[model samples]
Target chain A: MSKSAILRSSIAKKYWMALTGLFLCTFLIGHLIGNLQLIFIHGEEGRRAFNEYAYFMQHNIFIKVLSYVTYISILFHAIDGLMLAVQNKKARPQKYAYNNAGANSSTASRQMALLGSIVLIFIVTHMVNFWAKMHFEHIPLHTYEVTLPQQTNPEMVYYTHNHSLIPIQVDKVVVVRDETNLYLENTDLKLGEGYKDLHSVVMAFFGQSKNGFVTNSLALWATILYVISMAVMAFHLWHGFASAFQSLGLRHKRYTPIIAVTGKLFAIVVPFLFAIIPVLIFIGYVK
Target chain B: MASKTININLKIWRQKNANSKGSMETYKLDNVSTDSSFLEMLDQLNEQLVNERKEPIAFDHDCREGICGSCSLFINGEAHGPDRAVTTCQLHMRKFKDGETIYVEPWRAKAFPVIKDLVVDRSSFDRIQQAGGFVSVNTSGNTIDANAIPIGKAAADKAFEAATCIGCGACVASCVNASAMLFVSAKVSQLALLPQGKVEAQQRVLNMVKQMDEEGFGNCTNTGACAVECPKEISLENIARMNREYLKAMVSAE
Candidate 1:
């Protein structure tokens, strides 16, 4: 066997899948931890904290690099999976008249391609609903209530990128349209900064216009889809987490059992927590 | 022990040839002895068919004790019927319930094409073995004693276990992707564990895996179905070992 290539194409392809898959799993943990703040923290403090976190995620250089890595990993994982799925389908050109795949393998394992495609769809729509809005739209900044000079009613607020609301003179404040920084009137002196209220966007996206209960038809449907997407994610992770180690040739009897148990728990806990966020928001359980 | 007989219906696949489309043909088998093997039950059906001047169902079987991997039948959606760690020849009729309908089909994979009813072209396995399943040995009369090379008991036992693979395509048959990783990995592990085979281990793994891909076998999804359905109860550890060997070979290659 005097082959020039050391690694076969299929095995090498599997290496890429395993690497990208494990990277995505790490991304999931980080994402889940950040989102859990939606429930663990409450009220205006929670909103500000979340908004600040989103800002840091967007602006920090290291996080920016990691985000790009995440994007690349997601794309590679999805595309490579699709290719492998097609090849696998072709491997059995003639379909079995009666196949009971669930007899020996897991339903999740057998239906990985189907589950992955669903999760991909969810990811696309999820990014559109959150990431695109945060990146592209001129989101309104966190508002602070202040009464105008010579006015008793407190309605107006100043927009600043400063995550927390600070005491400011509304009369002396000069605001530029679609700008993040607050300026002293008629001067270039900067007063404070503002942050994109991503927390509000996330809260509104989930069916909580003002409360925990689903307020509108769209919010109800969106909330349901969120929960469903999380379920799909759970199923995908069920087989994928442990399977990655196998694909990577990291299988050890002593560690494998622990890894498998950890995978199963991760499958249940992560998605359940993720689903809980939307359900709570939909029902107005938290701000 | 008293032997019991059970009446069961069979939905066996019937294909004229490789080019022709196959379909499930139903047959009513009466009073089949539960102690008889599944192949024996099929033999009874064939004999009856012969008496009725009907064509006998074509199937592959040898060494009905399950050592020879020639016997292949997808019984009731499983590689070797519902039972685990047994080949089709070793499957007893007692496993089936009375009045139950068993669905029997050929091992389905692009690499293992169905030649007739339950006989598939498993020459793919032979071809894979030919690729790199052996160590390069030259007859120059310079061969050393077999026991000269020391081998650990654990390694020896694991190698022996890996060597037990009967070259059955059951692993391919049961896999959702029809992945041959288990079969190929078993061969890779069997030799790579020995000092004699270690010399060319890198080349062996590379060529074997390459040949497996060229044969149109799907990549492993780590579903564990192959190991679950393997007649020899081959461990998934072999596949993992192969992966380790392959990657090491890949990076260390000159």
Candidate 2:
């Protein structure tokens, strides 16, 4: 109970995990709301509206800073989870071959680290595709001046590989040309000036009407990952939420059941709602 | 109904002693009754082994009534048996079909080393309890009103449920993490709920958890597997309650 010791023990690890996981949960809600715009608005109007939201989020100093914090939260949550799991594993070096008691917990809950690792792989792939192009890559603002490449349409090539590349186009329409510079018209909006920055790229990526199938498919995968990850998150939160309260010393018997149920309700409802946005967009049921 | 009899096979673990090699040895038992409890059936098998001039299967048991909880065995894949709520001693042969092969093993935990065959040294749980669990009050000739504590029925019921844990290592045996939190929590919780033990509540939680850690029991991941397999259905809430108490104790000591 010494001040120095209190800062060091398994209890400290629990606090770190709780704080980081809760922070990520906040980020999920915000991300869902932004993604939900894909359903509410369609075509140019939808593109513009979504663009505006992305621009505001990117340009806003608070959100810009929060994005960095979000990155840190992800790292800390993973590390703390690993530390706790490893410590727990080392605490008991023995294992039973037949465990019939596993019926009570979901596979995701039992294999949290495994699920998190898969989600982590997805996140990395996702960031490299979209986030890299939007933030890291020096995508040209003006596409008209750039000569058309000698291969298949760059937009199609990009889409088939990674859905993060939003075809650049002006007014949601652009001219297509063959290698001979002949007039061959296609509506798959090519890359344009809006993709020069992070926010514009996000807006253009989600807003464009052409390549509807590709865009929707990517959204579906994202939604699936979001849903699966959130399901994992929910299971994590299932044990975590109630355990956090106890770790923080909330033990009033009357409040304990209330907190436990509240924890469960929050765990289920939040992820379930967040998972719906991508499905709505992908199925063309929304925007 | 009168007890029926049947023949069964038991793939039991045999060790000359803890110092020697252990392996699975199959033994055939004849005329085991469907109405006989699992322990009684074991008794029948042991009687046969003894009459045949073989060392009977080494297992632990005391009060055959299932209250002592010393009868620890892994029946088939289950910690106790297929029944949702019952101990091994309480498990009846009726749950199994005749001529079935039953795999009986001791409680598998690093902390609960095998004393012999199915009997394990679960004294680590006792050490965790001895560290600082029981109410400090001495048993005197004085009788205090039970109502003096003013505990609500719900709290009293929960306390009783927690107290139902008979120092069995089933929670440790069944847990994937081999966590003893339920057992430790039960002891810490039962005493903390009553005023008679309030004076030493802070020390009790701290000492018990430390002893629990020292005994090599895994931390509670709150998977709730223990509660499901618990012969007593000891709630995971008790573990949560213990965490709260331990946290409070840690802070107050600071």
Candidate 2 lDDT score relative to the true structure: 0.69
- Taking the candidates in order, what DockQ does each have? 0.64, 0.28
Candidate 2, residue A55: Cα displacement in angstroms equals: 3.8
TM-score of each: 0.92, 0.76
lDDT of 1 by residue, B54-102 (tens): 9899999989998989898899899999998899999999999999999
Residue A169, candidate 1: C-alpha displacement in angstroms: 12
> What shift in Å separates residue B74 of candidate 1 from its native position after superposition?
0.6
Q: What lDDT tens digits, residue by residue, belong to model 2 across residues B138-162?
A: 5596767667768778778878888
Score residue A133 of candidate 2 by CA lDDT. Answer: 70
**Which candidate comes out best when scored by lDDT?**
1
Off by over 4 Å in 1: A1-8, A143-179, A210-217
Q: Which stretches of candidate 2 lie over 4 Å from their true place?
A: A3-12, A91-94, A103-105, A132-134, A139-287, B19-21, B138-155
Error (Å) of candidate 2 at residue B150 is 5.6
